[model samples]
Target: MSARRTSRVLALWCPDWPAVAAAAAADLAPTRPVVVLHANRVVACSQLARSAGVRRGLRRREAQARCPDLYVARDDPDRDARLFEPVATAVDATVPGVEVLRPGLLVLAARGAARFFGSEEQAAEQLVDAVAATGVECRIGIADEMSTAVLAARRAALVAPGTGAQFLASLPVSELAVEPSLAGPERVDLVDLLHRLGLRRIGDFAALTPAEVASRFGVDAIAAHRCARAEPERAPAARPPAPDLTVEYPCDPPIDRIDAAAFAGRLLAVRLHDRLADAAVACTRLAVTAETAAGERLSRIWRCAEPLTPEGTADRVRWQLDGWLTQRALRGHHPDHDEWTGIATIGGQAERPGASRTRRTAPPNGSADNTVAPGRAVPAAPIVLLRLEPVEVVTAGALQLGLWGGEGEQEERFRRALVRVQGLLGGEAVLKGVLSGGRGPAERITLIALGDELSPAADPALPWPGRLPIPAPAVVLVDRPEVILESAAGAPVWITDRGLFTADPAHLRWGTKDWQVAAWSGPWPLDERWWSDGHADAVRAQILLRDDVMVLLLFGRDHIWHAEGLYD
Candidate 1:
């Protein structure tokens, strides 16, 4: 708090932001469920998956069964992160210091920025324009804090400051990410739970004490608490520095020679120091402007060696000019008659409008101007060629030519291989461990993201429960089993590797095999997923695998079953 009101923050949320962004680089769509699983392994299901009735945590079998027409795709977090870099840069241009909350989220300090850039709304628009340059459609949210800002963005509209809590109060409880709980035959969704608890909206949640919520939900209550009323944290900026003085020298003749450009920079620096001395302020960024002789212009920004004074500034400028002149003179690129004329400007606006930090500028060594006379006009003001503007602040990321070079593709593959091998060698290797909180083991089987923890589905068997359902077969075959099934008095007919027979019931023979139905159970009926569009889970059945184990099978959307799940 620089004697100013608390800093407001802006948070932007990009919708479908990951896949939508992936589409820009490469089209990866073909009717499959696309979920962006985070480093935390929580899946952010795509809209396509939702339409198919596949949700974030449905079992893999159930999801596929729900929409046999569905596809499963891996989520790329880094790609998602890179997609928003340009947008982040754009925001940096409009308002420098920004903290990326997530791949599709941005949080920026708004207190001083709002005042310096005008109003909160004006700054947001400017930021929007900057993001527009990156060709992204983003929803901007501004509020008193990070949490409110996030809610604002999610709502897909601007929410006035001082009113974030009210706006948040209007969204549904499900929007906060709640799970259903098993009570009777059917469980209760979070909305019902909230209603049961007598809490209406997020605002209502935000109003409760964390202790009160914890008493009921346990640790999960914390997340619920956040959902009810959570705000993200802001970046630190105690006393944001404003500039003491900034002076610009417009060039008449566009500057081309390093010597001439250097001279102009010196003059501007001198003027800047005089003003700074008067106002008693010191800044971090030094902006240099080069207006070309033909009106084509270039501006270079730099930081200072220290709290720069006019004399120190002039020496540095002369040194820079001399180096420029030498480079041109050696290459003979300068005209035999004309010299480049330009102006250099220096000052601070928000620490450095484009710079991420307030650091001093240091001219390269071995290139200082040691030949300038004590008192000499390094050429009179060339001309009002262009109005010089200081260069903005720059971070290391901005100056790079390639994306952040982390590991190569080969290295990544090797790492994955190593993990797999290590796991197999350890013997405790469980490739997939699904939670069957619902029906049986087969139904509980799940595929985990390589490093993610497996979670159990909601507990569906309760109230009157003592026995556990047998797990389904791990591997399923599309072809009916090659065997003949005959009742106490009958001959075999159908035969295949897929299974014994359809619900119509007729077993068969295979290879040199023939087996009759002795004491058999049922083709226990499993319904197609009501959630999925194509009826994935519509036709599922269970069978006893002789005496070995019980196997669950599915008559999937594709009319196939490669054995579903297996029981212990």
Candidate 2:
């Protein structure tokens, strides 16, 4: 058998989509500088914000500092997907078989559409116009592979067939990390490592032999290597999934509510994942189908660059169900209606020609009824059954599970447990600690809710003048307790303005307890916010007691000594 050629894919990308969704949801003016943040880091910013030096990964404080008038919004994946449905619907109307890579990105086979529209360029223009009609701006790219097409979409370029490799040749290796929603975010680190190894360009990395990349990097890098070479993401061994692998869930009362649909989708996704795992295979392309009470069948195919994990599978199902239910809700009246209007605005921008064909009105109950154009058929009833079928499967080796019973298995189990607990207790119930910049132990740590982006409050790489030495305290006290450090002469020990100790520390007393100081380390003074009225002047020291217990003590300008932390 000869080698299989890469498929021609068309990718549509909406830049700064999170910012756009946020602005539309908040009804912010188009000229306003907007940023959407996750875990206190700027994940997406509007064009206005970008012009002000705001970029992804910037700390919230810094982003705001760069643009003081920036309007900040939390990242809401549901909102992004919900608002993007019309755009996707518009594209689906223009060309069938649209595969959603994520909320703001879409991909499909370009051959048929190109032929129908007379050329690839024409199809790209038509798709762009379709999306723009719904009040959103988009860029389209056509290439021989989905990954290549995604990158091209960022530049609005079209790569001629069989020339994907040459087209990607001079692009920076960092391009591998672009559109993280399509390719995983793990590519960011891979790109950095590639740069350090002098593989600055995509072609340089692609030039390496497969065996070389396999020996030097992990599974992700190997997948990226294939992409760099403009090859298919799946290995040639990919086969059709077994018929028995299909999983389905029947909704008792039929699910019309978005929350209910989300719950049902998760259950079905887990079941499908378990079956795939049992079969020792992983799904690369998933077919999500839903049957409504009116016998209406809705189906969509989602293609992933990486094998679908349970979370990824669940997310796709939820998005599809949400899109289906939202479209139903938007239509407001009976699905049998043939006329409706398009969305009025996206990212707070006015709709273009062919936009605003639908007018959303409030029902008697005073709630808004969101409706979209009647281009695609809407389900006439609530969804009664949800099914998942693996359209394409590959051996589970792609998942990189640990050999036998190893750390990978253990880590996966542990992560599942955390997710379970989080599901039961709400997203903020569980917390994880992230290292951040500060002079004191407590200030150096930031507690973030699990499932959020683990961004530190400050950059740890920056120099902290009065930071504690090599080993951090084992325990940082949330409440500072008053203590007394005195000399053998029975006078309170103090640090002079010149930074000299008035006397050698002899004893320590706190709450009816006392200990003799065996040895002590001197005052590391910190004058924080000295230029402002909230300025604080403090000195900290490490003290060892006769009992072998160690304590971190601080003396503030209040002339009070407080125990700050304890060392094990």
- The clash number for model 1 is 59
RMSD after CA superposition, every candidate: 20.2, 10.9
Candidate 1 on 1-568: residue-level lDDT in tens?
3322375667766666665555544545444456544442325566776787776666666667776755444476445543454454345434545554445676666764567667777766766655554555677787765556666776656666456567778776555552211011122344567767877667777787877777766444455565456443212421243343446676556565555665776667656654543544543334433333433232223333123335445544444344333323332333442432211111000122342222112211211111111111122222244222222222222221223332122345655885787577753453545654545334444545445566655543443132234433545343533333333346422223353343333332334753332233433344435577765332344444444434334332244333343334
Best candidate per lDDT, number?
Answer: 2
Error of 2 at 438 (Å): 13
Residue 193, candidate 1: alpha-carbon lDDT:
77
Predicted candidate 2 versus true structure: per-residue lDDT over 321-405, tens digit per residue: 8877876776654544555445434443433555544322322112111222233345668888888989889888777564443
* Residue-level lDDT for 63 in candidate 2: 97
